[model samples]
Target: MAQSFGTFDIAVLDGGQYDPRWPLIHMTPEEAVRAADDMGVKSMILTHVGKFCISAHSWDEPFNRVVEASQGKDFRLLTPKIGKPIRLDGAEQSFSRWWEDIN
Candidate 1:
């Protein structure tokens, strides 16, 4: 899949899970940063992370780690909390906040 994309400026990997088969597969937080750097991807966002496995605080560790690792690199890795708005371009907007109101 990474090869097919051929180094996109912003590659948003929706799911956190990683497959080892693909060399470019970001199986770990560190790997994600490396891949984005190598591919010249400007931004990488990890999605599909929720409270299902560990607490929100616990998840932040790995997320922050990736961000720190990307420091000084051209790419930016981010893991935003629920409710934050990400402005892509024009009027298009995306929210990171989970739908807690939904029941």
Candidate 2:
């Protein structure tokens, strides 16, 4: 399916917290990054978080892991503030690590 779509500037993927029991249904942060890479994505944002006890990881672990997984990669990992408007067409694409500000 990715080949049909070509490369994407942004890809929204599953960043649901990790659980050994249901690995096939939910994606770990590292896996999500890999999925983005698989699709030739230039940037990625993790979703499907914060609303369930679907996994063992903390509510914020997905974000942290996604950042770690993005290391040395060419693509950017975006975690914008909820309800904040992101200007994707801008000359520079940047997002705040807002998750860092919370406990």
Candidate 3:
């Protein structure tokens, strides 16, 4: 749906809260990547995370899995801080593994 726009090349996906019982409601890392592909998204930013234990995976799992799933893909997976700016030109490459310290 997002690919309808000529400039809508980036997709900010909902990467939080995944459960096998409700696959239709939540999107996993792989699923999100597939969606980006479906929408012809050139870059992807994962949001709606860092809180709420709504699934089996840990809080940090989403970012990690997204990174893993993005292997060999043409699109970029961006994970930035709350206030940090994400470059629309896809030149700024910064990814903070913020959840590594948390247990």
Clashes of each: 2, 0, 0
Q: Which stretches of candidate 1 lie over 4 Å from their true place?
A: 1-7, 14-26, 48-50, 54-57, 90-103
RMSD for all candidates, in order, please: 6.7, 2.0, 2.5
Per-residue C-alpha lDDT of model 3 across residues 21-94, encoded as one tens digit per residue:
98888788888887887777788987657766778887888888988888887777777765778888757677
TM-scores across all candidates? 0.56, 0.84, 0.79
Q: Give the per-residue lDDT digits (tens) of candidate 2, residues 1-103.
A: 4789988988889877668888788888888988888888877888987545566678777877888898887777778777766566746767777877876
**lDDT tens per residue, model 1, 1-103:** 4566666657665334444554354356666667676777856776645434333234344555655676788765545565565554535444332333333
lDDT of candidates 1 onward, in order: 0.55, 0.79, 0.78
Give the higher-TM-score candidate: 1 or 2.
2
- Top candidate when judged by TM-score against the true structure: 2
Ranking by lDDT: 2, 3, 1
How do all the candidates rank in terms of TM-score, highest first?
2, 3, 1
Per-residue lDDT, model 2, residue 22, is 81
